[model samples]
Target: MDFCIVDWGAISSIAAALIASFTAIYIYFQWRNQKGAEVIANEAKQNIQDILEIIKIVSLIRQKSSALERSRNFIDFNRLYESVVRSSLYIDDCVEIKDFKKAIDEFFNCCLKFKEFESLYRDYAQDSKFIAHVDSEINLIQIRGFNIVNTLIPYSIYQKKFKFRKK
Candidate 1:
């Protein structure tokens, strides 16, 4: 009877140890999963915010371009071209969504320079050649911007396949 009791005690101790170990492992994994999820959520939020900001800047560029056409001075045209080229370089260097955001931010800075120039230049009417030059530059900027957007769309789709969202 004493031997049976000792055996029962041994079994109970082993079972309790197993349960505790399993619980610890489970808790560790659960915490890891939660941390992963939070990281993804934060990334998503930042990415979405970046995209929205880029969209806003693009919209502003379009609006400003329209008004800029009336300005005979081509001062903003050179700046716009520089910005577009810089943005193209940025896009070429990008490998991920966050890189994309950085590229877009660079592009936004360029657009803002163009915007600033436009605000200053649009106050006057000067020469037909200047107006024409500005118009041409705007066209080029539009084409390049569209290309960047097109290139990014596929990447964003591919990114969706990854568990960018932590579950």
Candidate 2:
């Protein structure tokens, strides 16, 4: 009787192949997961940039409001109104910022009423009641805008003089 010997070499080769295949699959999945993370990080960065841009627009509107308060005129009010309309584009995706937009709309409406008042009375634009109303509305818009911006950005950034404080 002749005894046949099993080929250990062939068995070892097959085991090695299986291990290599599993390693390749594991590496491929890891790469895919890494790519997905990179995409999400990029999107978050873009969102932050958009929020920053919107904050800048709000700041511009606030500055214009101050200028309008200093020199009340149809031209400055018209410019500020146009700026408020332009800012709507930035606040489209931001639901929290929508309140600020509503405030801007209210401020714009007040400007229109002031314009009408100026046209009707000419001298009543500087009346205490009208001036007070406009100032209050502007102040409200500024406070709301500052709060919204502070919520979006980090405290470090705000602490570095990027914050808007009521004077």
Candidate 3:
């Protein structure tokens, strides 16, 4: 007679544990990926909103207005600018976004120059030279602002839904 020992019970137990572990790990990863997508989508929505508000404020700055109205515009824009800067805390700032920020800073500097020019020479506000300067500023802003808009457009969540086109 020959005697041999085999542990079938132990082998089955080990196989079951391994399968359970693998399934758990797979589920965990899938959940994590879903959460990540949600976060990115939320961030995109927020960043796009901030950018649009900034653009609108810039538009206001371009328009000719009374000194009091311009002062109100300044107040509004200051608040918007601060919000945009604060948004960087949650937003994943890409190169285009960073460029947009730099553009905003430059615009604020231009705004200051305009404000001073208007204050010191209120009569000159309608002068050809001042009007020409404002026009030149508008021209520069059009070029720079549109370029940034192009880059940031891709980040908008509603592009596909709204059927946006590339220009």
Q: lDDT per residue, candidate 2, 1-167, as tens digits? A: 99999999999999999999999999998876555445433433443444344344433433453444434444454554455454433333322332445554554454455445334334544477865665565555455444544443442232222212223
Residue 127 shift from truth in candidate 2, angstroms: 12
Residue 160, candidate 1: alpha-carbon lDDT: 40
Instruction: Name the candidate, 1 or 3, with the larger TM-score value.
Output: 3
Question: Candidate 3: where is the Cα deviation over 4 Å?
Answer: 1-6, 88-90, 93-124, 127-167
User: How many Å off is the CA of 135 in candidate 2?
Assistant: 11
CA lDDT, candidate 1, residue 85: 48
Report how far off residue 21 is in candidate 1 (Å).
Answer: 0.4
The clash count for each model shown is: 0, 0, 0
Residue pairs whose backbone atoms clash in candidate 3 = none
**Candidate 1 residue-wise lDDT, 70-108, digit = tens:** 243233344444444454444334323445455555555
lDDT on C-alpha atoms for all candidate structures = 0.49, 0.47, 0.56
Q: Which ten-residue region of model 1 has the weakest summed lDDT? A: 158-167
Give the lDDT of residue 160 in candidate 3. 24
Tell me, by lDDT, which candidate is best: 3
TM-score of each predicted structure versus truth: 0.41, 0.41, 0.57
